[model samples]
Target chain A: MIPARTWPLGRAGVHLVLILYTALCLGPVLLVVMNSFKSRAGIFGAPLSLPNAATFDLIGYKTVLGQGAFLRYFGNSLIVTAGSLAAVLLFGAMAAFALSEYRFRANRLLGLFLALGIMVPIRLGTVAILNMMVAARLVNTHLALILIYTAQGLPIAVFILGEFMQGVSKDLKDAGRIDGLSEYTIFFRLVLPLVRPAVATVAVFTMIPIWNDLWFPLIVAPGEATKTVTLGAQVFIGQFVTNWNAVLAALTLAVLPVLVLYLLFSRQLIRGITAGAVK
Target chain B: MDQIDKLAADVPLLPAATRDAAPARTRRWHIAVFLAPALLVYTALMIVPLADTLRLSLFRSVEHAPVFVGLDNFRVLLTDPRWSLHFWAAFRHNLYFFAFHILLQNPVGIALAALLSLPRLRGQAFYRTAFFLPTMLSFVIVGFTWKLILSPLWGVAPALLGSVGLRGWFHPWLGQEATALTTLALISVWQYVGIPMMLIYAAMLAIPGELIEAAELDGITGFAQFRKIKLPLIWPTVGICSILTFVGNFNAFDLIYTINGANAGPNFATDLLGTFLFRTFFGNQLQLGDPNMGATIATMMFLIILAGVAAYLFGIQTRMRRYAL
Candidate 1:
């Protein structure tokens, strides 16, 4: 039998390690948010404490919100992320259905071609992509980011959806065929609805990267109207680097939305990841 | 074979009664139809540009037009001191950045994952979620947030150091040539450690609990159990995590770019291959942009990544012998 005394010691040690790590992980983010709420003097004086009545200040927020197109940047990020997700899911599912359900000579080759994109970093092709966008007169526009992200997001979406689709009940598709449903109709009406969980997983995986990406926005859409929250925040903070309060507030603003969304979807997000959906 | 015959027999209106008849032609067309749109877009956008980038590296742009100059761009990039120094420096810095992640990030990730996976740990989900919070935020945010918190003017770092009676040790870590790249790498490690942690945690969770229970009955618990029993079982997952870290670290851009600027300041000490490529492609304060040279750098990056991936596939992955349990 195990030694009972040893078990308590081991458990305590585990908690100790965990508690320390948790602090290390959350400390920097906490420090930023905490200081963002304080006046410059208070921030320096009591950096570890929460903002008190005298120290609480909105000057930082006022300055950050006053300068940069923060709200516009958020809207641009949302539209680009949402658009990319919709395209990747819709077209990706359709392609996956065909690859998994149907037999064709080039089917395996096509899948392999799509899978190659996963291994290769898409940013390596930025030189040509910028040129292509310029030729098409689409530079500094949201459409450019949307298209590029859609292309970037497609391979993973198709890979995951295709793998999941293979496990789907084949008898259902056969039954739909017998009911005189066209392949297109079956894909939209039956198959799409059935794979909702996979779609959700794909959305979480795809959206976070797209929403957080700074490279594309910097290169393809850095104009005032099309700047993403990531690019906008970077530029905003860079200009106000000397202003500690404003910089802290801007950082808090950039981090808050993602934190809220993450808390809401952390469970599903973890489940999706551990399910081997992305890998 | 029987299913094929049955499928063929169902369509009795066709001229041929055999299973391998005209219907196969229509079925092929149907498959093509389903696969067309996605294939078209991917090829047009991703494949074509990548292939073009590889091709463009061999040509020099002369008066806004690309002219074939095979190996010339590569020669200039390698032999010319101006181009070669920056390229080699960025390359070495990238290696250092990557080494930091492999050495620090993955080990820390594995350790946290191991602790989090301990049986009956209270608030396990809360710890997991909170720990992963930084990974969800944009790199731009992570970069700037750390930059501000560590700024000498802000006093957060100094105050934290004072709490531990080490206030004088604080420096402008991001602004110093000696410490800048290493600092950025550590900040990135802090933000992304959750990725490997979560991946390894999932892999550890996948190990059969009955095996652990059996080990426990044999007096295997705590560090002894972890070293002798758990580590061997999770080797393949660790291998995968290493390769993932390799690829991710090599391709990293936004963090360094945001925190240190595209120049990767303090005299380019923090510059990595990504920033080098960006500055080469899009001219900064010092130099005119050169597309051909930029493409050449990108092609080199592609080759490096490909070689790394090939090594992982052929070397580490094949040897890691995953446990069936």
Candidate 2:
């Protein structure tokens, strides 16, 4: 049956458009992944065709695992992203609570702070950031990347969370205050649960850039033990520039973990985005 | 006020009716406590360095110590033909790079979103997940994947073109100076089009169902319904997508760097403000690194972004009407 709200359009044409565009979006990524499973000859010979029995190979995976510390890099990336996400969410929520629940004189000033953050691409300050990192002796350390990523993410997190938190029934908060619960207790027990969906929204937005960033890791944490997955993949690509099979394998490996993680949480992420889209 | 009094009566509050209780001065410290951690990290690590970078632009290194040199670096960057040439070229290329997104990415995103948000559309979730998948991958992976597909040695692009009877039109677009920037820009579009689509689709979902039902009753339907009923409501979101694209395009570095390296060349054809800044700061084979010059370029980038943001806030944003849904 036709939905009550939907427009009555040429349904067949719409499906055709959506399917074609979806292919364009997803086709290249699938191709790289498919080609990763093939021999170099197979890859170059029939680029679009499926890998048959003769072309099927695991050589690329073997070379990548033997030559690179890919797992270690993934661990470093995970630590940095998880650490930054926690800081941004917790501290951002606290700041958002303060800015929203409490009517302070500095409130408008703080709002402008978030707006200025939009214009200031954090990388512009990398010149001074590097110097500061060296001074603090944080170079090649996960802490360095974490600090920068946390800082980079907080403004937007606070900005979004602050506005979202305002809609939390203020009466509920005041009742907790009247019951002698401290602000911290109220924030942790009462308000946070109310804003969980919004926090998830902020989490997805904050985590992606941290996971995929090549800049901060490239500058501050380029050490073998400290390299992020993105930086490691870059170095690997440079090292294996001529080895197509190995290059494709490394790309597949780099992409697989993210794909798995995304599938696990993608429903929550989409729901959270829609839930928090009420601006 | 009445509800608070009744709630206060029910609670074990021994003090006088706590209705309209002033925030106890003792508990006010919690505000600062709540704000301190985020504020400290954001200011010291982000705002301070931004200010410092701005300051660094006015100074030149002397004997490995910063020496205040006023606007000399800016003058040199703008006037010195050797420096000015690359700067202007990279700046121009950045505009073109941004142009490609404005022209292609936004339109495609809107079109797809409009279709996907239709009430009876099936498989919306699957399509969204598929569309957004590429944005999850690192620029390194995306750049390399595309490079391999478009490589002359691999013949994937040529082969695909041949299947479509346009094999002769194929070239190593990523290698040719004239085509490299455009090619990378399109790849970027392909990767990122989902973002605008998701955002705009969310906005479209926010449109009141009554509006659509009303439109249906009025004999307005199909694309015409979208134009009159939906477009006006979603205009603010579309504006946001535009500004975000502007900021993102100007800040872009990793994709170009991953594909073309720091020189951003086929003779610097794919160069952008971001890569140019990176090369000037880090120095390539041709020149020693110059922190002062780097800061100046960063300052230029900051100003350009500031101008863009300011223009949006004061100019374009002011003109758009955010419908109260």
Candidate 3:
């Protein structure tokens, strides 16, 4: 390693550039959240200032919470995200295990077939997907969203998990076999536990898109009963476009959960990305 | 004893007592068991629908029935003025959006990764997290947040610019036809630049320390070392980032839709293939929903993406070797 020594000018320059861009990345979000807590006049007049005693208000939050089916939307997102994450992990791992661990006739072909979705987006199949869902009489239901998200997330999950599974100790697997463990038992009891870190990585990749997706949800489950938080926020903000207070509050409400989660798991998330773990 | 155990363990496929009873074909069901669920879900929902979309694109609706009109919709989308106008306009906008990203986003991401990877950098985690925070937010949140900040009524954008002595430059860029798509592309770039940064940073970290140390001993340090050593090593990652940007840009809809609505407003200046596909597939204020035409548009997008990916895979990726780290 290059010895850490004084390059005061260069160091300051790097920090300055990083700090400036960080503010740019975060400033708009901070502005919205800050202004949401302010009075209407406070927002328009002094949008930059923090909420003071006179300016602080909850009218925006009241309006947003009062009008929108946010709780339902939150529940919908939670169910879809959780459901898709579980399915993607389980089926993805199984397929990944088979693809990496075992030799089969169509192994390479099947791997290539599934990996196609990674480069080609699933949204292109929306026309037929909508029809399939409609024909199945599953439109405007949570199952539609769950299944689509699972399909969308599976390719990347499999690709990543397959790479990790290839590195799993074959001796451990053979030992499991010698101990009279079936392949299913080997996968569930032995291999699955060994690849939990990769699972966590896959979980992050699968969860965010499902939670944040607007297109599939809008097409497949736009009904108020099944609207995700992202879709709900879109619709709510659209109708109340002129209502600055409600709009800001709705945006913040949409933002808060994700921001909180990111702050909590950012270390792991960054590690996963930086490890080149998911690619 | 160890050799005997090894032989015993390895001879499962031979005439061993337990293994000989079950032939390879007999045990094939286990592979099927492991692979079936994923194949079913993925094929039914993703792969089959993609194929079906291509088929749908080849047919047209006539008297509430889809008729086999091979290449007719594609003809209209390309040669006919009325449909082709919107189609090409959106296609053009999508190109611009992709160009904006390639120009601004990837370079900045590379730069940020370079800075973060600098030896003994302080608070690297803090900067990385801060930079990546926006990428975690939903498009609705990012779109609406930026909308509010850039709103002339809110005065936030102007106020921020005013502090920098450029208040006169403030305008509703999102509302203007000329600047709308580019502005939105920049907004998207702002949110997603972290992805490249993180990926590139990881790749850079994987560059063995000994190589950098040897370069340092040769008195080639800093930018020279990055240019000579680090850059070439990360070439494969940069290629991945490029293809990802292309695919993601083409697939992008939530941002434009969330911000500009389905119309992709200001006279459709911001219309992308994604927004165009949505409007055509699901009827907006402009026209009735037409699945056949929507499928046509979706097919065109898929072809375009396929071409890009094919070019990358066949044309570009063949030469970029991933160094064993």
Candidate 4:
């Protein structure tokens, strides 16, 4: 307080920059959401204005809801995301535990093998995955998407969870052993509960790609019953390109669930990223 | 208090077990049991398919059976004018895509990160959350929203630009072939700048406070302090951001595919290798679906990514070391 510090950009300047960038980031999204509620005339006439009584319309939403299979698409996405997240967590934790806790032969090689997918996308294997899926008669099945996504997600999950597992106090596991708990019991009961933070991190990382993935659903399950929200929106928007109201409404529908979930879990999500879990 | 609460939460999950419940013998199968599920799923679904795709690239189908044709597909992709023209064009567009992100997105991200990481900054979380909001939205949402906003007839782009005295710059950037790729690249940047910003912000936060305090005492402050002290320290994170940008940019298909369809229309001005691969495998009006060629293109993408990763590992990373804080 005795001597005020000088900055190249004053405090006010810094805030201006931040505020401008924030507006840049948020403006387009707000625009789309705003226009989705406006009538066709309002959308074309005054696209930037907020919906007023004269311009308000629910026709787009009604058309989107009435015409498309968005509910089924959302249900498919939920099933795939839930199924894949469960598989990724349980299997990824087990693998991370084995790789970290127990020093086994070929452990480093196996760990590296799994870690490959963290950098390289699994979509490259689509040609063969499609063939295999067709051969196994698993195409258009939720189980197929779940299994593939589990594979897609496991590498990073194992890597992140493995790092965290290595920090779990050795004393805790040994105490479990001394208490006559089996190794399986120790993992499910003791280790699992302790790594809840890492689990949340993994869930955020895994859920986004699986739910929003378009390529796999497009290739593996393009059928009406199997389409995810992302694919459904793509298809719906493609078909209704001329209708601005329906198009905006469909996109808003596709975006709202994820935006809501993100808002709900944003604090933990930011913590996970900042905690070096992603690094 | 938080640690105690977390410990309390964990206590009830692990039920107390008596000595009699334990098996006398050491169960050697625990490791295998734990590892098998992930291993089986990863190997069968991910690894095996990758290997098979590679193998498929080396063969051509003959009489309903694969005939061994070593590197012929690769040769065709590179030399045959029919395939090579599109291949080279897409490759160039992809490079342009990568360049824009590196030049624009990374710098912008670093700037935003530096601004957000400033001491005593208010509403840091609000800015961060707002900036990252688009990244969380599905590509469909981002693609469609941008498409609508950029539409000349109904979009707010021209109106917004006009209010800011930049009305003449408003055109259908997505519709013009010359501007389409660059426009899409910038749009892609808008959606993804949050990633690099967050990563670099995390790295900046990892820098110890004492170092900054020492720099402050030395009269090194503000932009100078950032240039000399913080910048050097966060180089590793910047390197990571670059390589991730490279991989993500090259592998990008969703936004383009969603907004521009599989054909990547306006005369295929926005076609990327991903969409090209999809069309080749799935067939389109341009050509029949050929798995061997599709595998060949996939293999090429894999090699290109591998090269980039290797360059980062061997060339870039060696120059940067993690400074001990």
What TM-scores do the predictions have? Answer: 0.94, 0.94, 0.95, 0.94
Writing each residue's lDDT as its tens digit, candidate 2 over A169-270 gives 989998998999988999999999999888988998899889999888988889999999999999998989999889999999988888898898888887
TM-score of 2: 0.94
Candidate 3's TM-score reads 0.95
Could you tell me the fnat of model 2? 0.75
- Provide the clash count, candidate 2: 0
User: Candidate 2: deviation at residue B199, Å?
Assistant: 1.4
lDDT of 1: 0.85
lDDT of 1 by residue, B140-203 (tens): 8888878777888767788889889999899998999999988998998998898888888888
Better of 2 and 3 by DockQ: 3
Task: Report the candidate with higher lDDT, 2 versus 4.
Answer: 4
Q: Encode model 4's per-residue lDDT on B241-320: one tens digit a residue.
A: 88988888655888889988889978999998988888888898878899999999999989999999999999989978
- A1-279 per-residue lDDT for model 3 (tens digits): 366432323888989998998888888888888989999988887888999999999999999889898889999999999999999999999999999998767989998898899989999999999999999999999999999999999999999899889888999999999998999999999999999988997898789888999998899999989999999999999999998889989999898889888888888888878765334
Candidates 3 and 4 compared: the better one by DockQ is 3
After superposition, which runs of candidate 3 have C-alpha atoms over 4 Å from their true positions? Answer: A4-9, A277-279, B1-23, B321-325
Tell me how far the alpha carbon of residue A261 in candidate 1 is from the true structure, in angstroms, after superposition: 1.1
Candidates' C-alpha lDDT: 0.85, 0.87, 0.89, 0.89
Candidate with top lDDT is 3
Clashes of 1: 0
Provide per-model DockQ scores. 0.62, 0.66, 0.73, 0.59
Clashing pairs in 1: none
Report residue A69 deviation for candidate 3 (angstroms): 1.5
Residue B147 alpha-carbon offset, candidate 3, angstroms: 0.9
What is candidate 3's lDDT per residue for B51-74, written digit by digit as tens?
999999999999998799989999
* Tens-digit lDDT track of model 4 for A1-279: 212363558888988998999899888888888889999999898888899999999989999999998899999999999999999999999999999998666799998899789878899999999999999999999989999999999999999999999889999999999999989999999999999998998899899988888989999998888999999999999999999999989888888899899888888888888896234
lDDT of 2 at B80: 100
